[model samples]
Target: MVAILAADVAGYSRLMGSDEEGTLSHLKALRRTHVDPAITAHRGRIVKTTGDGMLVEFASAVDATRCAVKAQREMAERNADVPQGSRIEFRMGIHVGDIIIDDNDIFGDGVNIAARLEGIAEPGGVCISDDAYRQIRGKVDITFDDMGSQSLKNIAEPMRAWRSRIDTNSSTVESVRPTTETAPPLGLPDKPSIAVLPFQNMSGDPEQDYFADGMVEDIITALSQVKWFFVIARNSSFIYKGRPVNVKQVARDLGVRYVLEGSVRKAGGRVRITGQLIQAETGRHIWADRFDGELADVFNLQDQVTSSVVGAIEPSLREAEIARARCKPTERLDAYEWYLRALPHFYTLNRESLDKAIVLLGQAIAIDPHFALAKALAARCYAWRNPQGWATVPEEEKAIAVRLGREALQDGDHDPSVLWMVGFVMWQLRVDPEGALELYDRSLSLNANCAQALALRGWALATAGRLDEAVPALLQALRLSPFDPEAFFTMSALGCAYLMARRFDEAFKWTSRALRQRPTFAPALRFHAVCLVKLG
Candidate 1:
């Protein structure tokens, strides 16, 4: 009659290693304030809350996922300041099958399967049975990468699973690729990367811009304070400002793997803001909310938003990192380091750096061409070669890059990195704007943390003369990586958009800001030069 969701807090014992009382206090606070309310809102019932975990029953899977994501997002944010090792990460499993209800309890094989699935879930992540994944695919704007059928403890049949760490809107959202090839290299130490998209300046008064602009800065600062997180610098993110972009492009441009974004609206004495936390690789909306409050509560509003974002992101990040750490190297392989080094090179669009990347990637592929990162990066190098003017007669190189990029996707497009690289290559090389756009869009649907993908898509939109749509994407890129090298791109694009729309004065102002950051950066320099010419 009901589906069961079983989840246990990862590192619960380690977190309570020497401070049982403190852990209990935090957990108790979480339950009373976040968990209980979310469940009630979603029309679900909590069967029990164990000291380290909880079991809940839902009449429908949709509400169950919504409640679970909400609980995880809030709790993780609350614990952002805690030491990394002491943080609590929850792994959840959902199973829709027959269940038995007793006084104050729910019992069934469904519960056991759910627990097993939870055991397999990435920390701060969700794993659902094929039954559950199938049920909710199109019902909600979320995404999942298939884990294939794997044998679980209680379920004899192969259990189909998906990683639910990222939101459906992540520009970098992607599922694990399905293939029988040997495991590819693991890249980078698993610190989480995220971008915060710009908040729409919904205030009717054009002068209220400062509040909207500052909100993202405040968010970036709050998110960066968590020691466990690897927040992107603000500069790189601005590249996406005022531009429409898919999430995957955001992830690519910033060299980060994750992204976060929201909007702000101030009217009268009250302000309303809507926020969502997304996994860049998987464009899934892991957590989202619309909050309304008086302007006087600005501090509280910022804090609450930070809490939710940190809560939603940290656990999932830890889980992803832990998964990487847990992978064992194959014979004659140092896959982890190889993967780590590849991320930076793969995102490199410069000629010299990309050339170097090609050599290293070839080595990686030779060692394990099955290495997903290597393939993706190689494709990216080719994709960006010509437009970036990185190569002489880039046409040949561009074709090669496109061929290899799709090859990489076919090899394992589900991995966030691989899919993101392929998508980037398609946009920069083939100029198949539609195909590129779809891939970029799909990437974010899987993860919202992909600021690079978002930025790229934003630029694509701007170049195509779609000024109105480009604004939010570029703004998001700025929020996620306030200090990214490419942030000026977003600023310049916003300046350009303002110009195209005949908002001349605004264009001049933003272009001037961009010039301050990088006087010689072509995009900003050109835009700024033009503004001066037009104004004079």
Candidate 2:
């Protein structure tokens, strides 16, 4: 018997646990509308249908994969009319191995291996074996990103696999390959690239927003005059106005090594300004200060902030830039809007926010088709929609995201925010974490203070088993965005890194702190539960 190719959905059984009838209705609907048709087109047969998933048999691995990818894309589109909470997502796995023909039922390592591979796939994603990839490469527009080899349960030999990125744009998906760099860092001597965000305007006058905003512009100008360090233009930094945000995200979006965020409060003709300097690479708050004087002294306040922020950021930045990178992408207004919309969505870090973000960012790209930020955000959002069960048709989202992310990079690979967003979605949702990690590092080198890049880099590092490096990076993210809700991810990541390092006490303590902020965090809750088990 020839090795059978198989794929199934992960967590389908549990998804049905809460709502069996509803999940079954969606499942059957998907099969009727998309899955059955694609399987027929590929000449594959449905071996059996589990309550929540399906076991399919194919003559060749290539046919199985082609059918799988096609089905995902179609189903994703079909599910668009459905609400996010009721979406049916599938994780697919393909492998070639002999199977026992048991009266309309298939059983053997072939079936089990495929199931394990499915476990590693992002929701609405496909993971294929070396044998499957060999048969499928160049046959379809799907490009495979190598995931090296993974150890599967009960399988003696490890399997080498590649993740498929279905390009919805150009229809030419090829194997993902590493790129070489040519541009040297802008080569700053003493200063560093920086962005100043709107400090909180505590005063009742909403007009003070402009005043707070002006302070940022002044600092950007002052830093620009430093005759060193590349300063992100004021237009880029001001995009963060009104929205509470992550400092790491600001750094990445603005392409700066350092970030200066503060607030202005004016009462009774007197004003107070508080500013903090952050090192984006380490997510560290390097310095902080508060200046007090009459509102007329605003000029002096700006001067003090500019000088202090410049002085504090430069040294930390230089130390990080010992290994630096070059920049790329949009100086256009359209791209900037895309970046703005994408930032809130991506950094908001939840299913509901991600969905809204996708819609808003798509609108941004509509304004500027060449906007790299919008493209990258679109790609990331698609990646989220599928696995997170945020939409009915998960694969549709993946295909679009894959295409948009690639286009965003092609438009400008040097944009730190774009690169980081793309990498994050690919790694977290596409099961291509290694690729995501590399992109995160590249983004940081281009702009050290990019808090989103740093947080993501730390996440990638932890996943890659580099907990030592992740610890400090997560800490820095917290320092930069002390007031932002995203501080939770950093605290949670800090706990995970500690757990990996076997610092159980630290892990428990840190996780406790994070839970204090968000008691219902699912992952944190699970991690804490495990830690308790270990301690017990």
Candidate 3:
């Protein structure tokens, strides 16, 4: 593990466009006199530099924070007399985490988090991850303001951040506000909405531009197919192509809640595609990832990237929307907001949370009788309650569950989520395994990357004595969503599939893993006990 520091000019493109020669000259002068000297004094190593940014490595977080603070102080002095538009201000982010060293350069979450933190930093300021903050807190004399938990793009979980409070006596940090001259911000659509910007061709091969552009188009098309999303059209998003953009501004202009941006790089026999999704309103990263494959399978690579991106962002956006709903006044929530509010409770997998989820979903359905997703989720909740011994009226719940499941299929058979959820309800209630299988298969046909559907299908197949097909389906679901909240359920299902196939050792392995995630999961415990008895 090492401390990584990422820094970039606030408006590099605009500065270069205004006066290319002068900007280049000034940047070189600043590096020579201020930035480089500060890094050297603090014992930081310059790992790499781009046209307008640099990545630095340090043995300690103290050194990295000291170096960044010193450089910003010097820059503040240099730009004291410069006009706001022309000042060469810098934003810096620091993180201390494990890094993958390759060819004398570094790659990994350490580098990615630092870079994303830099993206959200105020100009002439520094942002550091909690890992770095813990290392340098009270160790360094500089003061830092807690920036709370931030959802950085690509990183799996939200991270707490700290921003160094630049001393007013030494440097003045100015807040840059958005211009009022542009058109008023567009209202966000009813459903979760997003815009996918064209991916950059980072391979430096002009010919590869087509490949990158095509991938973006394909991703946009795929995301649009997810009935829950209100995806911005291709032409609207493409207008920002080849331009440096502020993500928050783009969100306003496009009237979207989320924005997706990425780059494609091609090497000799391989290509790598990287993508990150960010919340437009708060400039927070929601998700980020990279996909790599052989050039021979470029089209397949495109499809893979699209499926993985769409699949990953769906849950992320849902969680983000749930958080948004939580912050709103309870009386002001609409039907969609009510549905969003129910999700966290449902995922808790406990009796009380499940009861609350049912109530919230009932409220949502009352507001909009045709809210098929709510009905489907409510049906699943009822189906789950009976198994957990939480249902006071089992027969009544069974009838309600069946009625709601049928109504959901009638209203939203086209939606993959609704289909898979209703399928689970039917299967859990022992309605018909074959019918449930058909619903699962149809859901997969709609969105092959739907991990929940794959997991449910695996469970249904295993219970129906189709072990061969069940095992692979469950494994694929795990791959698609390794960190999924419902992963324990999949792991448990895999245990059952293995147990049914008389693979006692594999059953023991998966059941043990599932128990680690959810110790009291009854199905996994039963499978684990059976596995131990069989192995004995």
Candidate 4:
């Protein structure tokens, strides 16, 4: 395996359009003075150059990472006083993997991943694969922020990414240790709010952890579908996993009025789930229940838990809402199990994991072809694969995605999760933006708190140049899921909306916030660059 680094000027096309000769001259000069020296010093070889971009090979990930950081720092200093619109900034991505060498050219998944990483990287910043990060963690003194699992275009499975932090004040990079300081407790939302902690696995077998975790995820999804409930996103709530938790403290931390804690035990084709809803402010047990059922009836038990919790929160909750929340994803237990198995892999966002997820979801669909949720998820995986450059046959995957998505819509019109997931696939795969918007509307009508649908709707609106409608939807998504891990996506969409509205200052501010949260987010990076040019 070898370390590969890919980098390109962030706005090279625009720069070239404005001043072709000047842009080329500046790029050459920067290479000679900063880029070339850094590469040579770090023992890296330039594989090729594509006008504004270059591919390099390094024997060591440490050398590649150090080289990238050094070059970015130099470029930052170089562009310190340049006109914002004229400044040239580079985005870099690094990955360590096996490569094929032919005719003095290097090619493979390694090169593709590195290039895709560069595509999503922040201008003037570096993004590295988890493999590279593992190699350079203690060897390099620079601090790195975990970017979680990122879906790179055309790359299979999701890969965890890390961003190197650059200290603008000092020549030497410094490590910033995570602090124990927590933000002031957030105020509860206007509506009823709750956080469901990960259910404890009491089955004695460590392998059953997925079973319990999936159960919690389903509960969270069910509660989120309740239009009047403000439920914390799974990512935020899962932070308290495998640890002791204080209900009141969790409420304060998450800004929720209620906290749900539970345990799941499975043995001998039988499962028992116990759940309790606590009023956070007063530390009172609003409701508590234990459900016992055959393993085949796990879905019913989950629905019971959800209905009990909702009823506890508001005893007068309408029966229609309860029935809607209790919609069964699939009647086949085996298919449900397969679907559950696919979820963890899906979240990993790496090529292998994503492929595995697709396989699992496929199995689920085969077992129950009418399983709308499974089909929707499978379509989503295909959609994700296409954008990340992971799909080997774009046309084939597109057709499959469209088919699965359409089938899901036909079968799951009343299922909010199905509507939103299919809508996302439709919007992302460019099947139909208007249709996607309508799907989002339908999803919100069923589950008003479907933040993902809201965010995607806002993104679609902004992309369609409907700034007026996009901003509020995006803002509402942020308001509903304040602690959502993907909130940066909504923030970036808002930036795009404001940018199209010719509100450059607001665009800059929102994009800046997004980059602060996820520096490698491509949409935000692109919008922020434009905002800089417009403001200048």
The prediction achieving the highest lDDT against the true structure is 4
* Local accuracy of candidate 1 as per-residue lDDT tens digits, 1-536: 56688888875875688689987897777778987898899998778888788899999888787777777776666655654445666788888889887888878788888998887676667888888877787775456655545667666676656666634234233443222134332233267667676665645445555466567755765565454556675545555665545565555555456667666767556677778676656555556666778866665677777777766765554333221111122222344235435544544445677777777667767777566556777777766567656776677887778777777777665554456568777766656777777777766655454567777777777777887778788877666555566666678878877878777788899898788866766667777888888888
Q: Candidate 3's residue-wise lDDT over 1-536, tens digit each?
A: 89999999976996899899999999999999999999999999899999999999999999999899889988877876775556788899999999999898999999999999998776788999999999998776566755556877788998988775465364333333234345555677677778888888766456556557756755764675565666665645766666556677777776778888888866666677777777777656666667777755555655555555555656564333221011111222257557766865787779999999999889989888888878998999999888778898998998999999999998788777788989988898898778999999998777665668889999999999988899899986765444455678999999999898898998999999999989988899999999999999
The TM-score values for the models, in the order shown, are 0.41, 0.44, 0.48, 0.64
Better of 1 and 4 by lDDT: 4
**In model 2, which regions exceed 4 Å deviation?**
1-335, 338-350, 384-387
Query: What lDDT score belongs to each candidate, Candidate 1 first?
Result: 0.67, 0.67, 0.78, 0.84
The TM-score measured for candidate 1 stands at 0.41
Error at 337, model 1, angstroms: 2.9
Q: What is the lDDT of residue 350 in candidate 1?
A: 57
Prediction 1 global C-alpha lDDT: 0.67
- Mind giving the per-residue lDDT tens digits that candidate 4 earns over 262-320? 78877667887988787877665577678988988898888889989988888788455
TM-score of candidate 3 versus the correct structure, residues matched by position:
0.48
Error of 4 at 171 (Å): 45
Q: Write the per-residue lDDT of candidate 2 for residues 109-196, one digit (tens) a residue.
A: 8888887777666556788877778877778767666555566778898777666534344455533211212322232224356667
TM-score attained by model 2: 0.44
